[model samples]
Target: MSTVTSEIPAVEATQFQHTPYYCEENVYLLCKTLCENGVADATGSDLFVVFISNEKKQVPLWHQKASTRADGIVLWDYHVICVQRKKESDAEPLVWDLDSTLPFPSPLASYVNETIQPSFQLFAEYQRYFRIVHAPLFFKHFASDRRHMKEPDGSWIAQPPPYQPIVSQDGILHNLSEYNAMSGADSLSTMDPDTVGAAVSQKLGVVVSHTQLEELFTKLP
Candidate 1:
């Protein structure tokens, strides 16, 4: 929700650019301006702004921590790299210095891309019954203090419950938690999809057919 307004002039790239390239140039300029301001944490090592210069168009949004930097610097310090070049007449270069502007979208976007987006359809279908379907299963593999791990009824705390897998009609699986115990096992091989879907619906407090579940999964990101 934080808002940052900058009066600094846009760094113009001396070339005609379209929406995509112009956006990149703007981001580059924003980074340059932010690097000049030097608002990074003093205790942490200096941040360096980096991005691809077009050879690699699919530049990841995450600012990688330069492993070769000797100053113990972190990626958080230098967060922006306003894209340069490819400017067109009458097209305003856009800059997005996450350091000085809105919060960086990499972390959240990464989570969505690697986790949420892939499972979006599954989550949405399950959400109709259980709102918490999209939430990461609150798992407790081991407790530091086992003695203190007890429920309100004085019973031993049970292991965190895992959600049943919802398979799609096309056999495309999503949200497979590699860390989960049954992650290596294929749910469809042993258990029927209808049975699994029914259990999931029961746990979610809603009744849905396997086809409906598959449809829901198909509709999401």
Candidate 2:
């Protein structure tokens, strides 16, 4: 197993603001904060925003504080997180999931093992898919209108973040569905790592199966 040495500095997870049940916004804020902190500029650590769900919009994740079960599993419609790909060859990629009960800035390997659990078999509907967007592009192109958090009658499903809804740098509003959508055909498991990186960097994002999560980020250039 790889370890994060004390020589490596990481942003404390608590330094960022988090709102309950608003993972997408939370991650957007996280990416913004990282950029403002100049972590990416200083370390050349590529940041990626990951959306976890499937065609059915159901994803099972463990070690979630929101889980009512003793095993700490939550069946979410969709979830979002930030992944930092270190420039150092010896350093493992890190996952920042504010909603997870796992250690803050968990190593990608440990997060995958404890939270994603790719080895665990489940029904086809419960299978998890990932949408990875390069943080620079995600921060520039992403937007949310908060429509997903409202009931059909426009009531609140959960309290929203205090800040205004995010708008894209290009002024496009509410493109959350584009990022969250994952079709079966979008899986990049068969493609070479370079192709996966190209897809994520050039396109809005790329979707890969749970088994491909760690491979995709770890091998990214």
Instruction: Show where candidate 1 strays beyond 4 Å.
Output: 1-21, 40-116, 121-221
- The sequence of per-residue lDDT tens digits that candidate 2 reaches over residues 1-221 is 22574423566778998999889999988877877787654322378889898889889999998998887999999999988876665677778899988888888899999998878989988898888888878877889989989999999899999999999988988989988888667888566766776745664768888878877776676
lDDT of 1 by residue, 78-181 (tens): 12233111112222222233322222322222322331233335332122211112111111111122222257787865442122333333453432222111
By summed lDDT, the worst window of 10 consecutive residues in model 2 runs over: 1-10
Model 1 lDDT, residue 185, Cα: 20
TM-score for all models, in order of appearance: 0.19, 0.91
For all predictions, the C-alpha RMSD in Å is 20.9, 2.2
Q: Which is the leading candidate under TM-score?
A: 2
